[model samples]
Target: MKIHVWNAFASNNSGSYTIVGRFPSEELAAQVAAELSEVLAAHEQWFRSPTAPRSGEGSRRETPSPLRAFAQVHSLTQGESDWADQGELRAWSTGHQVFLHDPCTLSLPDSYEEFLRVRGGKVETRIRHAHADIVSLFELRGTLPKKTKAETVRALVEELHADDGPLVTLAPFNLQPAWREGSKPGEPVLTVGAVFHDRDLATGFTAVEGLARRHGLDVTVRVSEEQDSRDSLAWLRPSHPPLKRKMFDVWLLEAGYSPKEVARRLGELRHGRYVDVPGLLKALPDTVLKRLTLSRAEQAVRFLREGGANAELRPAE
Candidate 1:
């Protein structure tokens, strides 16, 4: 089966391009690229705010050189690939950087003076341009006090109806690095990944704190005045749900896509490893069946039906 992948790259006037990520489809990659462009525009607006230095106030110029950012998408195949230029944007400043801060380790700078303190050192007390780090959002990623404690958090979160609120994720982290560094033997690190936008910090803080205190869980909850979240938290985002939900079984009565094509299209939808379609079709007793979400199953049925195959969905019991 042939599978396709797309990569998004951005040049943030950093003198070189950095890979944003790989996506299941070009459309998804393009969407992220557009968001990055929007961020640059917002950064320019912040630079032009009233805090900026006035003419002859300091060594600072009335305006800084405009910054240029470009993004590109590449489509990959087994052998060959194609590249497409997404476009570029120009903003007020010549520098752009995104940082994810650890509040406990370093307090983020709020004003120009604080910005210089965090960024600059002795001999350079102050500088020319006005700069700041816009706290974008807050993220939570940590290990539960106990392995089984995860279920408690989930239950408490559900009790509070937080399942549908801020995105909640529980995944394992490899402790191999720690082991190699003599910190501890390799062990399963259950990491929590949750993101609360700036506006929703109150809800997120209360829920997480309540969960920890009520259950005696060791997870710490903190909130900052400015926009806050870590860059590593972005790694939690994926094209598909991390955990599977109840799904609908799609059945094809006649020959639809060859098992090969079925694998390709479904892989695009699922965002997981390749499914063994031919093997499953042969092992099943009757019609070829596949499990997918209701919307995804409907799409599968449509594609199969258009190919002259009778297709339908059987709700999972």
Candidate 2:
């Protein structure tokens, strides 16, 4: 097998270190990424950030934790914890690279892509490093002749990707298509709670605290003292994308407004789009509301119900 390496300066952390390749087939490349998980782990050698978050941080799982993301996954809580891994891999080049060297003028990614464009090879792979002191990534700038599978990339692989904070992290073992991920950066999130048995509030808080300590996240855990009460929820993330805001943007787009126009209008109204069905109805003057068809509003906010309870508006701590 022939091997080539290039430097990737963008993702320098252990979780950022990765093995990537373009196989003759996408399926084959995926398999190789899976198979080599173990082999790469064996080859990895470096110290990195601990898996646990810093004093107050959150968990970051773009993909599942390394064990789940790779084959023959092991863990400190599991056997074969000796595996090593540096970072995540992208089957497709991220198209982000910078060169800081003499002769760097023409030897840039634009030129590099031009070179790869000429090579007809169909497969590729790269092994990355996790050492923070190291400022370069080991990458491949070309295609591969064929796909190859090997295993062994492991380490604080998952831990490296975890968030650094004091709040408890609680990512679903299997991430749902939850609204959390796609929200705008620094978007505020509501910490809503439900009834959990004849609960001592402390139990829920303690559990959530433990989870946060274990995973570093700004998550809040709440179990209302009132049984079967839907009155308990808190706001955590500030500047968070409200469900109503998203609904409004989509609605306006369908209403034949350009995205730019919709955004401009929302800004003029101080995020007028960020409202639930009732809130939206109440906010609009009857004259304007009458002009807007129910069908159109419903289309924009899928959750627009004729009558239903909404999450209580609890003041954030």
- On lDDT, the leading prediction is 1
Residue pairs of candidate 1 with colliding backbone atoms: 135-227, 137-228
Model 1 poorest 10 in a row by lDDT: 172-181
* lDDT, candidate 2, 170-189, per-residue tens: 21111111112122334322
Clashes found in each candidate (C-alpha, N, C closer than 3 A): 2, 44
Model 2 worst lDDT run, 10 consecutive residues: 148-157
The whole-model lDDT of each prediction reads 0.35, 0.25
RMSD of 1: 17.5
